[model samples]
Target: MDYIQPFNRILLVGCNECVTVCSAGGRKEVGLLSSALQSAFLSAGKSIDIKEHTLERQCDPEYVEELVGMMDGVDAVVSMACGCGVQEVARRYKNKPVFPAVNTKFMGASERQGVWAERCQGCGNCLLGITGGICPIARCSKQLMNGPCGGSTNGKCEISKEVDCAWQLIWDRLKMLGQEERYLDIIPAKDWRTAGGGGPRKIVREDLAG
Candidate 1:
């Protein structure tokens, strides 16, 4: 917070992608945060100017380029996007001081209105095909691949009765799909490299590369 005080003008940028869907770093969230910051500054007897903008996707350079014109009088940038978008912004504008306003949580899906649940880990090797579409890596307390641990009881996770055991869900789904036999198959130790165990990972499409 002290680092931001030096800047007289801050640009609050938002993403209209995942953050918008989850109601975290969307345009609405940008406005709320901007107002809150302004109030805090005014209360402290300091004046600060904040400009708000929402990009279709802050992670894409084409969308981030829109900020070029908006950056004219901005002293710093505060991104209301996930970590990826923040890094993209930083990469595009190395001269500007860029900061993330929201913490990036796990890759997840909206379970219901106002409820988002972790669904994927972006492990590179997707196991949903064999796990009956349930991802144990993200949902399971221990991220067990082969089956449920002893902590699972009555289809509920040991962490909480409210949390459904991912393995149980996988088994039930596999049973319904007539693929219960797949559960008996042993999943080998995962290759750690694809899951970012090796430095930063990337996908380069030769056809799309310039």
Candidate 2:
């Protein structure tokens, strides 16, 4: 991500809303990134100035507008928000370059207190009705739409013992819900063309637009 721009006065901006809820891009993360960048620059004897700021919500235009005046002295900004927030910042400040500090993982729920696992692939077509509500695309290592490969043993995936096979979870869930017959149906291969295309994607809802 750093290869996108050459920054001198870098502003590490974080968000206090969704990013904070996901425990990724928050005030603490901003401070940590600022300190780390400062240390790296100092060690290389490079005179780069870095600052930190946390917005209530980076995606909101009102909150992002406040950054316009503050960006006067900065050369570039490293936003710690999701891809949506990064694009929002870039859209607001078209003259300046904005880089993403954190990798946008996915839209999913947290498995444990601090462990968030991805459950959706945003394939544009959802097949949870037949898969017992478990997403094989995100959970399975191979993203197999069908049952677990011969690699699953003792409920763990062949790729790693620590990871649970998605099919295993689906089977268990179906049995618990008394809907094991759902797995009998076969699902076809997902079309990658509808997902991410060769370039950027866009969605326009004429009715939703004012």
Candidate 3:
């Protein structure tokens, strides 16, 4: 990459968490990236020593500390995990330059064999109970909580025909559950302060601490 300037040796670290399940930065992906980097460096008339290792979960400090044994002669690190994994690695090893190889997409679920779709936005307030289990905040393009937007036509969103109208799904599910009356109730506006809008979020559980 343009960022890995003049690299003689680099460590390719992979995460076996969400990235592994998504087939982005698992063990197999780490090997493939290592080979690709080796080929690129060789083609440029400069051989590179690539050390590949896949951590169980790079987001955890216990797993990130495993990189201590692999740091020798490593000019830089190429993290094939999500943004969280990359940041953890950078935080643990502040002296080394960590570069990301994969773009962190979203907090999503696997739709099918190889497809993943966004499911939750981690909003502090959850209204799935009233919305009939569908998250309008994430599924709806407009994030409307009251009712279906004027752009909804034939159960599909105006943004795209392929995208379903979240409100319509909620309505249909509520009707099936014999709770359509709940749809008539007005939902309060969201207080984004509890969400990331306030700042970087952190949870401290005094009960769990020793």
Best-fitting candidate, measured by lDDT?
A: 1
What's the residue-level lDDT of 151 in candidate 2? 98
lDDT of 3 by residue, 20-127 (tens): 889999999999988988888778888888899999999999999999988877999999989999999999999999999999978898989998888899988788
> Per-residue lDDT for 143-205 in model 2, tens only?
998799999999999999989999999999999999888888778878876677535667799
- Winner on TM-score between 2 and 3 is 3
Scored by lDDT, model 3 comes in at: 0.91
Cα-based lDDT at residue 17, candidate 2: 87
TM-score of each: 0.95, 0.83, 0.96
**Ranking of all predicted structures according to lDDT, beginning with the best and ending with the worst:** 1, 3, 2
- Lowest-lDDT window of 10 residues in candidate 2? 1-10
Number of clashes recorded per candidate: 0, 0, 0
Model 1: residues with Cα > 4 Å off, grouped in runs: none
Q: Tell me how far the alpha carbon of residue 59 in candidate 1 is from the true structure, in angstroms, after superposition.
A: 0.8
Relative to the true structure, how large is the alpha-carbon lDDT of every model? 0.92, 0.85, 0.91
